[model samples]
Target: MSPRPSDRRSFLKTSVATAAAVSVPYIFTSQDARADEQKSSESNDRPLVGCIGTGSRWNAVGPNAMQLGDVVAVCDVDANHANGAKKKVTDIQSKKGVQRDVDVYEDYQKILDRNDIEIVTIVTTDHWHSKIAIEAMKAGKDVYCEKPLTLTIDEGKKICQVAKETGRVFQVGTQQRSEMGLKFLQAIALIQAGRIGDVQHVAVAIGGSPTSNSIPVVDVPSGLNWEKWLGQAPLVDYRWAKEGKQTKTRCHYEFRWWYEYSGGKLTDWGAHHVDIAQWGIGQNGDGQGASSIEPIYAKHPVEFKDGMPLQDDRYNCATNFHVKATFDNGVVMDIKDSHQDELGFNNGIMFTGTKGRFLVNRGKIVGAPIDELKDNPLPENAIAEVYGGKDPARSNAHMANFFECVKTRKLPISDVFTHHRALTTCHLSNIAIRLNRSLKWDPKSEQILGDDQANAMQSREARKGYEVTV
Candidate 1:
């Protein structure tokens, strides 16, 4: 199950070899930031802020952003969501029993146009993230965007380029890197410390998406702007139907179950667990990631023709999948939709290596290797090193780290660069499954090797009006 008794030299070789090679470069400089906004944000304890896409996730991200900064505006295509967010932010910021009115907008541009706003929290649907985030950075606003950060591999590239170009302190809301009681960080620390000893394989179990019945076409809700909500993707009729009392729609929280909008659980939970897996193995770097992605198995709820789903009325994303991502360094990562409960993992990551193996999730970190930590404790700085050389305790809350970085101008805990590399692997997995084949990848150039058809899936053209602007 594990490696032979190895000498100190070989153990050090396995652990320290990759340590210096993959240190994260977390800081970048921003250009053309307005003097007044910068002065107001940096000099003041709380920054002036805005919130976009205040549907389900905003109940969490909105308050987190508002707690760190004063929310002056909120925007959403849905009037109900926008008005709801207005009350949420005002209630959080208002003193004592008194509350204030927050500005609400159907168009996100108004918030971006404000010279007074210093930061914006983007919790929009997957397709809207890149466009609004890029434009916000150009307008001199720092951003805290939710995860599954890109709709396609090309979107990830554009986001990284603009983040570097604008020098914005952009943070992707992958809280596992900061929160979850630091179990993920501990797992990474153990891997980097040779406790797992040159990890040969990583198994990530994020459960599958659920299949849905054909949701009948219905009139778009009165307050919701159906056209704007479908920005970037091809416009489709509003679909909503009740199944035994539960509402299934083509938008909002259920959007992840549709390939046109998101990548199902591969990106949903993969954004958290896979991000950590790559971070542990030191693959969360430029030009040093998965060399190939192969789909072992995949099953979707609807039929497919040339990778596009045939039915528009049902959830179309893959319901079950087993994808393998191979690294040039001989580490193979297997990402599956789910795992057996009797196998000791339902939703978590299991890292197996030559020396030992351990399992980790939000709840706990356990295995024979973890038990060995008692007599042979890890180096004191192990977790700190995995956490970009900062005290791990400092970033206990993800939003706290984001706001702290907003003032210090340091990189947020979950910066855009590493996230892009991790997300690229997830995107490649979905592409391989959709095409029902394996893929050769060139990490340095960020391309699909030897496959023209597969390469085209890396980017998608937006509808005429919603294209991302440089």
Candidate 2:
């Protein structure tokens, strides 16, 4: 039998030292001695990896994880997805002139049980992120989990706690932090150097949450494990349409539109853009967040009570919302959907301060402060400082950094604590919209002050047998 939660936690604490000392290194053979030497010069130590959630989003991260280490196994609730990912990984390895066979599994616990696997990349659904992450940490594997890290504030907190207690190197997949030549880092560096001149406001545009009319339940896809996919979430009928038509709202990409599984764009893109905004505004740490969140304006497809959508068939996340959050430092943040006249990028973050403002997205960073950088550039080591002394020029640097930390035993730039804090802001915005009212927050205590119902929304009771054990 798999170890119990308490046993796993205790094992993690006791076994970490031994595990690190004797961890296996994945070695790849080369066709020639010269080629072998070249590969050896690249890195002698490559950790064994197991990827969970081999779906659409996993396609990107799953491959990237391979670039950092050897993937020995793959897991997914969908049999087709799991098999497809296995083939992809095998093909990639074959192209690299390496002969490797990857085992496929439907249960993530099977991957965690292997003493050979040292790292786990979690690309599962929002609701499964926290449970799998905490369990993986207890299983003594360093983790690289995709963001928005958890389904709710309570989940995020548990993930953070378990990570801390396990002393595992954890990296959240908010790749924007390590992507695009570290543009977000540059923006934050400018802000910290007083370039933004005592910033007063930050505008983050993550697009609108999804909205859909009531969807009809349909048959479950042939190879999908509907029950396991809905782990920790209320068991509902599997919904999908025939091959061509838009079927039920519970499959693949459509899952993001529902409140039961996700927080819509609020957590979908909000996890990315809002995370950057909080980092830029210096509210990206535990006990550092908005002091008050006011729902300036909001609208949803279905009516909600006690911060939950009343209907399960339709997309319930707010489709259109504009919330104003004031931090303890008296900085105001406007998080909203794109508008015709708003001064921000469509799916990016914009920082507004007293002196000047700048906007950054995947494509570019622009505005007056950025323009000024033409004459006065950031310090040469700015990005290095941001990345905790790791070289930012490495290919797929984010995953590379995680691999490095897996060896060095250091925290990655995108750690869980700060991520949870930023996600709290996004969660707060959604809660305010669900209630269509303003709410006060005590950042230090991480509570919705004077609002019991609102505070209660910070967590949800998981379905039996799937509860996330911290």
Candidate 3:
């Protein structure tokens, strides 16, 4: 059993040694040497992995995890996904000359019960992320969970507490810190290097969510356990309908638009963009965040009451929003769907500071400040310093970092502590938009000040069977 919350809190405040991390050599940087490195460092002379929530994202992260460790099991509520993942894992191992049959199951607990499984990757839908992750850590397994790691603000806090108590190496799959051509990493380094004078305001144009009209309730798909798939969310009829010869769904990939399962673009994209914004502004740390969040404009396809959508059949999350969040250090972050009309990248972050400014996305980094870097170079170790003293230009990047940290017992680049803080701003933005109001936030306390109803929105009551027990 995990330790009591009080004991955990006491331990954390006094002797939690996250900063006392063990430095690991970049032995897993190349594919040819990764297996040899794993054999040398992992227990029992092999790294064993189990995967939960093998859905759309599993294709990307799951295979990468398999590269560092031998996959032993795969699980999902949908049998099709689980079986598909099993075959994929089996095929990948077959090529590596380590032929083995991978166990497939619908219950995630089965994967946690195995004593040999040292690592687990969670690529589930947004709502189920925190619970499975907490349980895995309690089971003494290291975790690599996908982004938008929590459905609610309080859930993120609970995950962080459990992680510290378990002493597990948990990596949040916000790969922007590690991947996307190293642009985001460089952006952070530039801001810290004072290439841009004091950051005055940052705008994240992550694009608006797609709005869908009333989707007709349809029969649950075959080979799917809808009840278990719903997990902590309230039971609702399976909804699907045709759109331009394509079937749009409330299940699987399209769950992002629903408020019940996900936080739409606010989190779907905010998890990547807002996280960078907070990091660039030095707010993605302990007890640091925006002092106030004002919902400048919010447009929804359906009306909401008490943060719940009045129209049950249509997508309800905010479609277009322009929220202004102010930090205690006198920086402002505007989360919006679009940038300047002339600058139509539609998806990028623009930083404005006293000295200069720049905009960076996955494709490119542009502006005068970036151009000046041709001659006005930063320190050699600038990017590595931002990345916690490791080389970010590795072959497998994020997954490789997780594998390395699993051996060292150190926190990875995107640990839960910083992610929860950055994600709090996203969650708060959703709350302000849902209520159509502004909020004063106490970052130190992690509370929405002066609004009891908004404070209560920080957590949701889990369904009886799906409570996220630590």
True-vs-predicted CA distance for residue 15, candidate 3, Å: 50
Task: Summarize candidate 2's per-residue lDDT along 1-470 as a digit string, tens digits.
Answer: 12345544543554444344224322222336335433543564677788998889888998898787888788887778888998999999778875556778778888899776789999988888999999999999999998889889888888878988999999999988887777887887888888879888888788886555555555455566666788887766555543345544676878888878889898999899888888888888767998889998888888777676777656677778899999988888888886445563567777888998888888888898898888998899876777677777767988888888898898888899999999999899888998888999887887888989888989998888998887
lDDT of 3 by residue, 374-402 (tens): 99888999999998999989777999999
**Candidate 3 deviant stretches above 4 angstroms:** 1-44, 341-344
Cα-lDDT of candidate 3: 0.85
Best by TM-score: 3
lDDT of 1 by residue, 1-470 (tens): 11223422343444343334223211111234345445655666677888888999989998777666777678888778887787777667776332334667777888899777889999999878999999999999999999989999999999999988988899999999988888998898888778878889899999999888988766566567666788898766667888886778888888999988999999999999999999888898888789999999999999887677877778998889999999999999999987654664669999989998889999989999899989998899887787777675743378988887888889887999999999999999999999999999999999999999999999887888889868
TM-score of 1: 0.89
Model 2 residue runs over 4 Å out of place are 1-44, 242-248, 339-345
Ranking by TM-score: 3, 1, 2
Among these predictions, the greatest lDDT belongs to 3
Q: After superposition, how far is residue 420 of candidate 1 from its true place, in Å?
A: 0.8
Residue 296, candidate 2: alpha-carbon lDDT: 87
Clashes of 3: 0
